[model samples]
Target: MVSEMSKKREFKDDEELEHGKVVKRFNGLPQFNLQRFCYRHNPDVQSSVGSTTCYKQDANRLKSVNDKISQLPKNEREEVHHVVSTFRKSNDKLRKLMLEGILTACCFPQLSYVASEVQNMIRIDFISILPQEISLRILCYLDCQSLCSAAKVCRRWKTMADDDRVWHRMCEQHIDRKCPNCGWGLPRLHMKRARNPTPTRCTELITPWKAIYRDRFKVECNWRKGQCVIQEFKGHMDGVLTLQFSSRLLFTGSYDSTVAIWDLCSGRLIRRLSGHGDGVKTLYFDEQKVITGSLDKAIRVWNYITGECISTYRGHTDSVLSVDSYKKIIVSGSADKTVKVWHVESRTCYSLRGHTEWVNCVKLHPLSFLCFSCSDDTTIRMWDIRTNACRRVFRGHVGQVQKVIPLTIIDIENLVVDDKQTSDPPTDDPHDPLTEDLPYPTHILSCSLDNTIKLWDVKTGNCVRTQFGHVEGVWDIAADNFRIVSGSHDGTVKLWDLQSGKCIHTFQGKSLQEPHDQQAETAPHKVSPIACVGIGDSEFFTGDEMGYVKRYRFDTT
Candidate 1:
């Protein structure tokens, strides 16, 4: 019996060992080895042993503990179970903390990058961070008024906004193609001062583009609102026939047989050019000389600055009605039913014979290569100066053709070529030859006694559009890219949209007490016929038969 009992005890021990082996493989800890249990379960402990060996030992220890618990009394077993459950809960909490720490370490670099990007965005300054060239490019998109308002934002912006390059672009857009001060179709001086300054005669009076644009804007506002400072230039004894304006000077020719030069700003008569023996029918002037045609069958050239007669050429058989000049070449049209091209230096003349009746107006192309003349023969003719032959004859006007002026073109092959060759740094200049090629009326604007104004494409020799609003004969017309202004014997000044061929507004002389207070909706006043018209940057000047020169500002309001 003792031998059997000993054998049973050995068998029980072998079973316990086998059970522990199973637990060691399946569970994380071993059964009932106190040291192994404490080492595996302690949250503060770290093992240097291989992980698999440690896990096996821990499993065996746990199984031994569970076996001991099953062998104990039920109450003691329950108490031991409660202690194990508490340890497991503590271990789970510790595991969660460690997992969180590991995850944070792994994500640290990415989190740091995100934080830096956010900070950079918060500190960014557009004007300061961007290069000046890029900043100017962005600002260029704003209109004149908006750009001026942007200048008041801060000192940095103000400095950039005041750049001559910026203002130069604005000036090109708003100002006339010709420079007011220099009288050059394209000003020769640099639009913006170069990094290295080049000496030129006009560079000293470099166009103040910023000031020019600002003043022009103010003047435009005055025109739109009918708020103008009217200065009546009254010195003519008879009817004022033709007038031309420079920046500071005004020249007028009249039936009084005299031509008067006035200081435009001061309204003072600077000098009287008085050599014409009969009524001065028409006149043309540039920076150097003033040339006038007279009813006395003479063309007189005068020094505009000194008011001295330089020379007189008498060739026409009848009254000289209109004259134009470029350099030393003079082109005159007469009631003698002929056109003459003269070389002032050589005293040589070439008579162009085409018109069967009186020629009323003649204009030389900017390059002096072509001449345009309108005559009572009801034809508008373009003459080739080099060959002295009529090239194109426009014949749309039923009545006598009154006036013809060149319009801006989409591709201005003629005017722009001369402008580019004569101007500096053809690209940056506000007078860029390409600018005149914008989609505007770059043809010929002609009015007639037929009470119609026609836009004729000189290249195609076709009438593109015809505008009709005047009740009487359309006496005179002036145009820019945007609008065409016409003056008529109807005693009205009409503004027409060049693109739409629509009359957008009308100014009646009879409705005005004076040009300044003439409201669009006011009652009509007694006025005389408009004999002549002159268009400026923001204003237009009209001369009546009564010898009154009325300056009208453009007002939208």
Candidate 2:
């Protein structure tokens, strides 16, 4: 309720004086007054801190003020209250004048008392008072650890810190790409619904973005610390050669001329797919079908669901070395010294023939409509699938190129590599961004019989970085946004940081033990080469020459 004096007094509406013709409201701030309270201590606003206990300094100030007031006579206390109430209702200029007059009348000891009290009272809860938009903008600048700490401050803080919009920005910084500030990148979640951070209307129920970020962050930490449990799968009669996996199952191809599918959760054989006439050398699969290439010189498509061979494609006269596909387009590399792109629906086959020696790897990058092939000829070629013409040739490897993986490396030029010829990788800043606007892949990772893994700049066709860890040849390698997993002829598996090009962890070869055996064997088993490798969201699989596959699971939960 307004006092009668306030009701009678006329005050001017807030407006800015025009030095020019146009006039405007004084500011965008809400209309307010100093009587009941204002910016300093508004009755309408909640207490700054949410906890039940008062802050120590605030409690001390309150105790001292109450002590002084209680000591005064009843009549003097009423006079003091009137003076304080008048000061609270005064405008800024009047209050400052009143403060100066009070200070002038005080002696040194009194001035010292006022100074100490003012110091304790000056601090404010700015994040709580600022408009939410400005508050969130301030929070956005904080890193993950700092942001998480802020969430524990209070209920209001937790709501703002765990906001979907804030977590969405966090995901955008670290998902499928390295964050420039922290040098950390998280694996992209396979589920499109959760990973796709699309904006929603205010009325719509938003996804739990902070939870998604937390789970992925845990997996990334496991990868970095090399914390994992190893599970071995054994059944093939000959050397295990290639493997791939989904969220729930693991697939392996072997020199036994068969493909094996195992339940990843149960660690049991789900199916034994037997159709290839010779050793299965390479394979790729999705939810619908499994495509395998064999030393028998044929590419076979199987309906793994029913354990049936849906189709057989025989065109290469020599052993099929590698295979990859997208849509109806199947690309195959062979000892016939060629890479074949088969459009199954159109019944058309286009041959890419620049490689002089056996083509060892074929990779299809569907997004750019391009195919990458590395060969024993010591060259990696990027081909335009639409034209069947080799767009560029990368020539640097001294030995056969065993694998080629097209990649989108963030800040590819920053990594240090050892290529023997150049003792150091270039630390020069990246070239123009427009030069990187090409539809083709940004970089390529290739391992060779040369016993080294190389990172290449796709646009410049130059080997930018080389990783050397395996004492023998790096036969096969797999990579994701965060790290690289390589299986080598040295009878070891190595994990690498893709960003830094540094070897992080290495596992020595170990033989599988019989699960049914009652007595454990004390004898040491023979070590064999790791011929193939596959990587998933929180795990990686290595298939060795002894017909054994090991799954390294990194997720703690």
Candidate 3:
């Protein structure tokens, strides 16, 4: 060991810090970049700053500094801590010198003590007096999650981050930001493989976000900052059961037992058509008309333009559970164990009777004009709509099959569907469940009373995967060829990956415990399960057994 009296540890000038002599005498050296420390502390120093070798040397010097610190006496350690803590409270040069003097007396502990102090004092409030623009720029340099959390810390920060310009810049930095369905210029194989385990359809994952921003409040809209508007559609009573949009109109069926048509662009409540005696269960629209199924055991066809109920077809003895229409025919399934077909214009109905229990949902294959239905019997039925016969039964679910959709089917249904329309065909065709361009019709999603969501290959008649996490039976399923949205009896909606079947996030409207405890029975099926689900843009909407409806905007930045 070197003699203490002969060792000169204190630096007389900045140039000495660049020399290795001070550290050469010590053993407890820290693994740090002394050159970075030198540059940060004295920006005027112009040494050889461009060499990698210099960095390695700084690392060695840091090691020496730490080694020397380990040998400090106990009183010196306490004195160092006290001086450093006091120094952090003010930026005076005298205080910094005093702190350095005490730390040197304690054998100069590693700069990590300084780094820790800096990190602990790195709150955004330090620059609150600075120009809002510059302060926001500094905030943006932080991680996205921290920025979001900081914005929520107080009303002042919330107002600052609410600036659309800041949010738009933040959005650009997120790795998983892209079109909801489009991969960011990636090839199909990489995209598919990337999607397989995670099943994120697009290149990037989007969190459903619902934060208000400054641009939304401005009368002079700047689309460049990103177009976000608080558009509200009003018509439903209690809550809306389900909503669907076409090129021109938005159709909403509600707990009030009525279907309302609204102008999509204006968010205006155009007209409300009343027919169902109980809450509407589900509704969909094709080129020809709006088809609605309700708890009143009826499926009604309405004129899209006039909002007039054109024809009401009734056959099922119990409440109609789901209705989906293609080309000219309306297919409806009911709690009464039957799938019925109706002619949109003539109002004639034919029942496809085979299910042993409640038919929960119906989907039409576009090409073959096949009709598929899932039921409480734990089975899915594939039918030939033309023959009105059951073509096949896919049975394997431990709980009810809440939904069935065909990714692609024949063109015959579209031809028949187009001929029945009173208006011209849409210029750009709306999304059809039966187009061959989409992936396998086998990609099926079903929710069940068993507190799980199941994905299946309906064409292969195989259950592909099961997603568990929902505390109650899943009542409905919706997807965008990547992620699956499920509604549950647990009073929440969940988003899950189709491939891994992992739950990514959940959205809840109300707590099940908040409702009447007496109404909640211990019986397995006693609670109202999620009855229906629909997705719009970044929002997921769920309707429950008690007629409550809620919308949750995902939290993607």
Cα RMSD of all models vs. native, in order, equals 23.3, 7.8, 18.3
- What TM-score do all the candidates reach, one by one? 0.62, 0.79, 0.50
Point out where model 1 deviates above 4 Å: 1-132, 145-212, 224-226, 304-307, 366-368, 410-442, 497-504, 510-526, 553-557
Worst 10 residues of 3 by lDDT: 184-193
Q: What is the lDDT of candidate 2?
A: 0.82
Better of 1 and 2 by lDDT: 2
Which rank order by TM-score, best down to worst?
A: 2, 1, 3
- 1-557 per-residue lDDT for model 3 (tens digits): 33453365554433233343443312111212344444333222112221124432345555675677668898886776675467657656877788677567663356667767678434324333345667678776665456668777666566665555675554444322222222211111111112235545552332222122221212112111222232444456555667776545667787789887777556577788887799787898877678888998887878877777887777889998888877777788999899888876675789899999999889887567688898989888887777788856666678877777654222212111112232433224343333445343544556778776655544445555566798777767786533567877676677764334567666554444535566456633343456667754344556654545444433222
Report the Cα lDDT for candidate 1: 0.70
* TM-score between model 3 and native: 0.50
In angstroms, how far off is 467's CA in candidate 1?
1.7
- lDDT (C-alpha, whole model) for all candidates: 0.70, 0.82, 0.60
Off by over 4 Å in 2: 1-36, 46-60, 68-91, 94-119, 192-207, 411-438, 511-526
Error (Å) of candidate 3 at residue 328 is 0.7
